[model samples]
Target: MRYFFLLVLLGGLGWCPAQAQAPAARHTFALGPTDFLLDGKPLQMISGELHYPRIPREAWRARLKMAKAMGLNTIGTYVFWNVHEPQPGQYDFTGNNDVAAFVRMAQQEGLWVILRPSPYVCAEWEFGGYPYWLQNVPGLKVRSQEPQYVAAYKRYIEAVGKQLAPLQVGHGGPVLMVQVENEYGSYGSDKQYLALNKKLFEDAGFDGVLYTCDPVADVAKGHLPGLLPAVNGTDKPAEIRRLVRANHDGQGPYYVAEWYPAWFDWWGAPHHTVPAARYTPGLDSVLRAGMSINMYMFHGGTTRAFLNGANYKGDTSHYEPQVSSYDYDAPLDEAGNPTAKFRAFRAVIAKYRPAGAAPLPPVPAAKPSAALPALQLTQYASLLGHLPAPVASPTPLTFEQLKQAYGFVLYRATVPGGRSEVLKINDLRDYAVVLVNGRRVGTLDRRLRQDSLRLALPAGPVQLDILVENLGRINFGAYLLQNNKGITRRVLLGGREVTGWRMYGLPFAQAPTVAAGSPTPAAASGPVLRAATFTLAQPIDTYLDMRQWGKGVVWLNGHNLGRYWAIGPQQTLYVPAEWLRKGTNDIKVLELLRPEQTALRFLDHPILSELSGPQP
Candidate 1:
């Protein structure tokens, strides 16, 4: 009788019996009163979250296969809005941002998908996954019912729908559910805003089971009246049941949407790790209860480029910028290799596999890695020599006002100098290198709440240059709305506002050209553009050891590999093979702080736990 029903289901979805491995076809997935109903039968979704933008496009299949081997039946992913719509009215869904293709690949790997396409996904992403251009919109209030914000969000949702809506479950795709605004209750209790998001998704053609996920304390506030309320950060079967029953209709279908097996790391902090023994018991309980579950990060990939976000809990001293590697230390590491935790979790899940289910595949071997001999950066260029035309302003302009998103910004002005004075830059977003007459004088760091520096000026007019780097935008808390990079306010000298500034937006949209020359003197300070070239017999996965380097950003073959700091925690950047070539490969480094050595190394393994002094 079960075989007969399976045949009928396949026939209804237009799948032929011979095509056993065909892509997912049209099907019904609905929230039941006591359980999630898949074609009128209860279904437990053993899922894991992996963002498309985080993983390289070429390795999406391998990552999905890894998830399956870990005994996961589904793949959960967040469609980063900023990744798709980088600029207002401008959209990109190609290459690494190809979310639809990722979903299709998941289906091809025999896995269902849970699509979280929220405009505000607090996934440690820049500006909470909001496009940086949104800040330039006048009278716009994000995460609210403001008219302009709503219009812009609707347009973005429509754009995403055009790419992903057709891949929903009912449309013969793998997406079983689409999420509402992520963790909105913790941010705000605006039911109207949640309703607007729901309507927007519907208008965008998301016609599957829609759900809202939040912490246990926020399920009631974030959940819509008719949608499923999923809990995060907890795996206790009783708590999960109680939260779902209380927010829902006092029934069942309890879902732990975000089960954290480990945590993420931030700059200047130790790498976070959770023991498998800590959470496997909770997993067993949830599985034994027949409740559905989705691991927050089954495979936490890298937060490449300037996309990493920070945490500012309304206090300057509390600001913590996230590191480039988003390797959440889950079952799968950043390089897509299974860890000991993977085997432990798989053992727990194996016992819960449904009857007649296919055996889990053997874990795939780790990808090959290569270690290169130490090489010196042979070319160097001073940032002062490569200045573009500056925009004159009476005062320093914020990155938003300058129409810039990421990278460094230079503020220069001529100040009368005769005596030493205290230099203060109000609202310095992140880090700055203060230089007088093209010579490094001092530095100010926002992480340490150091905004004022005592500088000794020469006996004549001196060129004052303040090079500011936008570390990462605040991704969580009330400070998220106040995120403005570079120098947001006035520059004061000895308790007075200094005016007449020439602002240069160094977005570094492309790798700057470094003329062939010997390396800059190690004694030199401030920002320097360094370059090196090498040839590879074959491209293989590797980690660029930035331990000897100071605070800076690196680019390989014109692709930005993100930032690294001598501050430790994350000592290396994962260099994917997909971004490398077999011939000559060019590499560039924009070192913000002077390094003792001008050399680089490639390691076979990542150095994530090493610690060093915060200063260079």
Candidate 2:
């Protein structure tokens, strides 16, 4: 006992048993013939997908802890290229976009990682995670074997490799595997392009096992000769396994990379939810068959700012934008609270545990939220009153041509031989508000397939203004090629084309400071900037109810709270308490259709499911 106490004292004084013991052997993770082998032993991966940019930076550890509690040994996440490389050369990995830190946090919570670093990750992210600057490159065709596209892709992958390559499993980190271009077979069947993606990953120092994930039907087309193919879907694991095995010549170890426990919600559509019973049994069946699975989203976070992507199928298609809240009805809700799905999954995972694995960790406590009283917005500034010197152009330019990524663009011109007939805007990308002589006339929406509006022209010369909002860029399908916002072609009025225009590109990249040199708004006519200052005794997270306002964006204390439309579905913008202050907080809204009675309200909860349009 005296010797033991002396040894303990010596250990605290920099002497320890570890120094006397032999070094632990290095563990290697590899793809086995039938299962994932860690140091020549079989391992089963139960993963949950999430994005680092979606959740708050401070809440990353808590979210990972929640995943660990739900029997998730792995966390899958996609590295958004656009968020890291907002500009062509300039890169940012700080704040919420710090993906390395996110991976390290998962490791700290005793979890492994699966990385999906597709430069064109189509996760309903803006432009499918492709940087908008790619559109500016001459003769660049994305997701193809085009030289320009491949060159830019190589540069991006190299940059990512610099930050993450050293964190792979072999380097004493938790990154188990990295995926190539996401579900490429669903988009195209070009083997050469897919091969190039694999080569790029290898060149970027990703030496671990690489895989391609695709829907069951597209597995054959998307699967490469040497790389493993992983399936994605929710139903019929037996058939999906057969399909994946068939693609790999009857391989044994099947992996489902994206098992959708629930779907995502778009604006004007009902929030998506799947019953826990429907998937719990299906998940059990998959595990019983010895196939690894990764839930598409164990916890879906909010798609804040103008980063939400849209979907446009074709010319005769409905243009739908994704809602701000991406609570995909997963095991963990957007607020990181465990649900029925979480408990169901835990039960299923417990039944499928390996021979000697650790017990599931305890669930973390839910984050508390507060509801504040509505604060009235009084000060106002019109968007028209805040136009910078315009870019001169003969023909109307798209958002890409104007070097603008997201938000609104104002096009102004003088009517030639002014006549009040029909005004047609050729291929208006998404939504447009028309005004003649600074007065609200009519709106043309892509959702309703409306491109022409009746213009009552004044005699001699009339000023024409069209404020176009890039609702979102298509994150899926071939429509990604045609995602440029703003008026694509020339505007025609009564068969006479309007020429000689000044374009004001309103990216709103920065926070709203009172639009320079603008008169106070008296009557709401055109798009206006509404401002208000509210006092809070204590800072608390609250949702800003935007039901009273029309289509627009909001910023609170320099933080972009995302877009809001009276278009039902999403009526409240989430404002985090971190963006608020103890004494005073500033709120600004750029409403396209200015309200008669301008005021701002706070809601206790989000209005993500109050659908008013046709059910999707």
Estimate, for each residue in 1-616, the C-alpha lDDT of model 2 and write its tens digit: 9999989998899888878764423358887777888878877899999898888887788889898888889999999998998888788889998888998888888889999998778888899999888988878899999999999899989999988987788877789889999989889999999999999999999998888889877988888877888888844667866876787767656788999999897877777878999888889888887778999889887888889998878866788888777778888887667899999999999888777777777777765667788776677787787898899988888889988888889999987435668999888888899998889999998877888988888777788899998888999998887778899887888877888889999999887776334445566688878778788898766788887777888888887878887766777777766667899888888888755546677776677777563443
Clashing pairs in 1: none
Which run of 10 residues does model 2 get worst, by summed lDDT? 514-523
Candidate 1 lDDT for residue 248: 79
lDDT of 1 by residue, 279-391 (tens): 89999999999998999899999998899999887653567899999899999999999999999999999999999988999999989898976778879888887899999
Task: Specify the highest-lDDT model's number.
Answer: 1
Model 1, TM vs. native: 0.95
Alpha-carbon runs more than 4 Å astray in model 2: 1-26, 416-419, 515-520, 613-616
